[model samples]
Target: MKIRKKPPQEEFVSQAVRTGGDGQDAQEIAFIDNALFHADHAEDELFGEGSERIEVADWHFISPSCLEADGPPIKTKVLTPKQEKLLFLRYNYARRRIRQAQIRGAIRGTFESLMIWRQRAQDARDALVNANMALVPAMLRRVNCPNVELEELISEGNVALLRCVDRFDVSRGFRFSTYACRAIIKAFHRLASRRATYQKHFPAQYDPQMEKCDLGDRIHRQRWQDSIEWVRDMLTDNQAKLTLVEQTVLLERFAMAREGKGMTFEQIGPIIGLSPERTRQILRTTLRKVREAFDKDTAGPVQLAGA
Candidate 1:
């Protein structure tokens, strides 16, 4: 069986830069460029269709730098006269609206007009973002945060880029790239700090089993404390049918009070002037009544230490 080879891509020229080509190829390139130039001006018209021509310059395989690695930075490419003029227009548009918003801060109907100007400003800023995407990778390489992925750093840099556009002062004569780079670096640091704090609370290698055991222990301790509180309240209840001697015996026998040592019947019997057997009988009867009351008041029986 014979294998079929793939055909060449419709795009012949790879990039904006020129390379050695014959007169025929140059003519073809010029024709394609002219078509695109007209297509870009058409509104709501599909490319490669009636009254529309395809865009193929950006579709080709070309390094954004469009120059030698030893040459000037890629961000410098956006500093052309046309781009500068567009940026100036966008800046002035946003500036006029900002002043208007301030003047009409107390007015109710100023919002819609302010929003329109803001949208225009954002469109202009987005153009700047697209032109300066090369700067993001360069800055991320410089930061060298091993923990963060290149994609995450790029996303953070994009956010910082938007913020920089909002705050950039064109009158200062400083390049937008310089201001945006600083903001992007700060964003990277903030993200790293947040990740560090989160890791401190919950480490990367979390264990659900350990957490489950800790939860169980906490629940058990809570139940034990509730049981102790219930017994103490029962002993102190003046309306309960328990006699005075029985209350004293319960409090002393279970260490419910600070002075209690959970004394045996023999020890408590002499203090109460009763036989040890009689004291034990009263203690058992009082505990049985308390247990019954506790079961009735709560969902389940309390776990006595030695029932």
Candidate 2:
């Protein structure tokens, strides 16, 4: 597949050159575009559509280095002039709003619309963001590992920051720092997981065994009876080496789970003799096999786009 760059992404970067602060005024800062492209089309766990438009949804964080006049400048990219200005404006507003709320004793209300809306919520969240410069990075860096590269962590951080922005509710008596930290950690794990060669090792080729199976969707998941067959297909050599116990585990670990995401490593670790790492490797291997079978039967040229 041809890999091409997408439209520039927007991000912030700290540069080397220092601006002379005029008396009391602060120097304006510029933002950077640090997004890494994943595919030439809309790829998910696997690339889906679009021959030209690349998908950056899987791009990771490249955390930035903060030392001055020490080592060489970290490998970094900058955003366009327009995007930089917008980022500046966004952070400025976020900081100001958080500041006003703190100073004025303005406590927001709790999240109550979750019950009424059930599924669709327009005014879902209201919360205090990491307003002061003091709290923002501390909130975002909860998951940063010193062993990991800096720029990568920051890239993951941006995605986490956005997630926190979306899910935060100030009225809940929880600080934005607390909520944002968890989100950043989750985003970091997701980005880190992408480093695994899921695509390279497991390609879902077309199949015809089950007439109408579709793997690329959240909907149309196989029934328990059909799930048995699916799990069988997932085993190496198509169940030739799969034990009865292994099949049972797959049923509960993956097939029975909603959304087909399977049990987490911690959750599934005790059930099988293997550790979580081994379980993950096995699941990844099995999933690609099943997905390939399903795609051949249902998601191939036989189905319409978005079907």
Candidate 3:
């Protein structure tokens, strides 16, 4: 039997692992691109056609000219078999972390960021609706109408949604849903209060009373204002004196680092659209300012309340 010469092991392996960019080997590049594409979007339909007609912005993968009979496969890095497996695992883990971070971010932004303030705002909104509902009964009783219909109240609810949007203060840490309900109920109450029947019970308070109407109303107004004022005072009293940049950085870090975990200073900078080194510098400066502000201004004995 004629014996055919066998290529050396190193040569055979080198050919298999060939990497270069002298000319793009479209077929080889397509294979590599396909792996990464599927890893990113499992259901993605990929066309390995060269991008001569499609731009990168269109998310097309095109093989370069190198391997199209013009040159050897374009040189490029490829993971060793072990490295490829590691890359696959690491990418999946990182993607999961990103998703978890997003959920945490939504929770914090929606209700947890300003917890107490949001609660108060929501309470106020609910109170407004309750107070408005109370008005209808008061109106009916005053008019002595056992036949008062339910339609008006339902219509009033729709109006409440609008009033909530107009009056809701995001700065108050209350969701619009909470505050708008109050404004809506208040509208209903105002509408009902003008009725001649309401005068029976609320006449004195609702302005049917001739003499004490102004006094009663002013007092009520001040009391309502005071509740809001109290929240404002608390916010101001404990407020940290962070610069805009500092706040931006803090929020960025809070988003990147979640669940009691923290991001690298490098990670935060990119989030806030800054360089990683710049991010670190900002952190040092901002932390110093916050500590000093808390130190100099914190209430009795510098005790922390979720500080």
Off by over 4 Å in 2: 1-149, 198-307
- Predicted candidate 1 versus true structure: per-residue lDDT over 1-307, tens digit per residue: 9986533431222211111122222222210011222344422232113422211121122353433335445433455644543464454555454444544443444545555555655566566666666666666656756566656766787788766765665556567777778888889888777777877887766768756657787888788767777777765674246888888887778766765357888888988899999998888887777766766666543745642
**Which scores greater on lDDT, model 2 or model 3?**
3
Q: Which wins on TM-score, candidate 2 or candidate 3?
A: 2
TM-score of each: 0.39, 0.23, 0.20
Against the reference, the lDDT scores of all candidates come to: 0.58, 0.41, 0.41
Ranking by TM-score: 1, 2, 3
Q: What tens-digit string does per-residue lDDT give for candidate 2 at 1-307?
A: 9977433321100111111111211123212211212223212211124222221122232233322224234333333333322332333333332323323331222112212221111111111122212232443444544434556756567656755554444345445556666666676676656644453465564567756655744344334445544444445455334455455456557545345565666677687767878776776655554556557555222221110
lDDT ranking from best candidate downward: 1, 3, 2
- The residue-by-residue lDDT of candidate 3 on 1-307, one tens digit each, is 9987646854443333232112222233211122443365432322224211111111122243321334344332322333323232233333333333333433323222223322333443343343333222222222322222345644554565535433333334333334444555565565555554666655455344554448887977576455334323433553556666776665455432234545667777766788988887887776565556546654523322211
Indicate the residue-level lDDT of 110 in model 2: 12
Clashes of each: 0, 18, 11
Best candidate (score: TM-score): 1
Q: How does residue 96 of candidate 1 score in lDDT?
A: 51
